[model samples]
Target: MMMKKTVCMGLILCGMAFGTTAQTRGSLGQSDPKAKVVLDNVSKKFKSLKSVIANFVLKVEGANNSVSDSKKGSVYLKGAKYKVVMGDQEIISDNKTSWTYAKDVNEVTINNVDQSGNSMTPAKIFTNFYDKDFLYRLNGETTEKGKVLQNIELTPTDKSKTFFKVLVDVDKKNQTLARMKVFEKNGNRYTYEISSFTPNGAVTDDMFTFDAKKHPGVEVVDLR
Candidate 1:
């Protein structure tokens, strides 16, 4: 499978690297400081977010002349454990196995840390960002929904399942993440609107486990 297809299953799993202003992108050393500040600051904030729950809306634009579509969903995370539901499509990570459910196809794909190529894990992206395969860039600041945000860009460090540049919107003053955009290699794009953050909430470890009996009719299609 193509890397874009793999990461597309985990939109937020979209990783970061480097870029210039909103208009330009290049090597990390050449990245604009303005964008770098946001990326660096946001990375710090996300690292501090041990657990959170929130809902968001996702919009995806396809490349290859494909059409665009939108999905409304909820994302919940407790440490590395998370669950995201985009309309009928769902993704759940228990920190052990990542289960992605596609209602449209009645399919469930299962993957662990090693087999997942580490690209499907969003938190891992932050943990290994220091790797030399990537660079950083800074854009400018803008206001989105009453919040002052700094726009930062990230590029990939290596060639994997996907290689798409990422744009992260950070809260300039509070050093929080507001949103992100994933530029896919296939010419498709995805934008994430993050809202309703409940920091340091209660999330149990059981939420990450895969229980086919609990989901009942939900088929467990272990792709791995």
Candidate 2:
């Protein structure tokens, strides 16, 4: 249960790695044009890449501004396929089937990918998700680590969503996503900082799947 929750959160962070180019819905009357321009540039940049490999740091904070957990992870994305590795957990999907692997137990769970809901996926990172799901505005700029970052604040359109707001920091010079912070209603905050990103990385379809033959005595739980 804990691992599943962690993977879900990690996927959400990964989904926001690239902005979208879709048109904003009419409900987003407050959306900022300037922010959309920045996001559009990011979208165009990511769309030109054939694949991406990114290293990131995830930080979870409690309501009292105390850090609860921190983990470093890497994600590989190519078209509709993705693989995420963090500590002892890995989530991989090939746009059809999904696998969740736990290294500590040497167990892997398999299931079908459900694209009917608002569930975030690495492929959605390139879709126009923000235009339909969020109302955003430009929140000014700040200098971080000697780089000028344009801050954009986003509010979800659906009131029932678990998260209330998301803060995105875009690298002004490169027009790439730099950081993202999600604020939940329960006072839990999740932050993802992109440490490094490599576009057009060498990746193959087999890398997105698990091979039990490689792991001796591995257990497979087919939940699909």
lDDT of each: 0.62, 0.78
The residue-by-residue lDDT of candidate 2 on 18-69, one tens digit each, is: 2232344665567899998988888888888899998888888889876588
Enumerate residue pairs that collide in model 2.
none
lDDT of 1: 0.62
Measured with C-alpha atoms, the lDDT of residue 153 in candidate 2 is 93
Cα lDDT, model 1, residue 57: 68
Alpha-carbon TM-score of each model against the true structure: 0.73, 0.88
| The candidate that achieves the highest lDDT relative to the unseen native structure | 2
Cα lDDT of model 1 by residue, 43-92, tens digit: 67777887766666677887874878776776677766777766666678
RMSD, model 2, all Cα superposed? 3.4
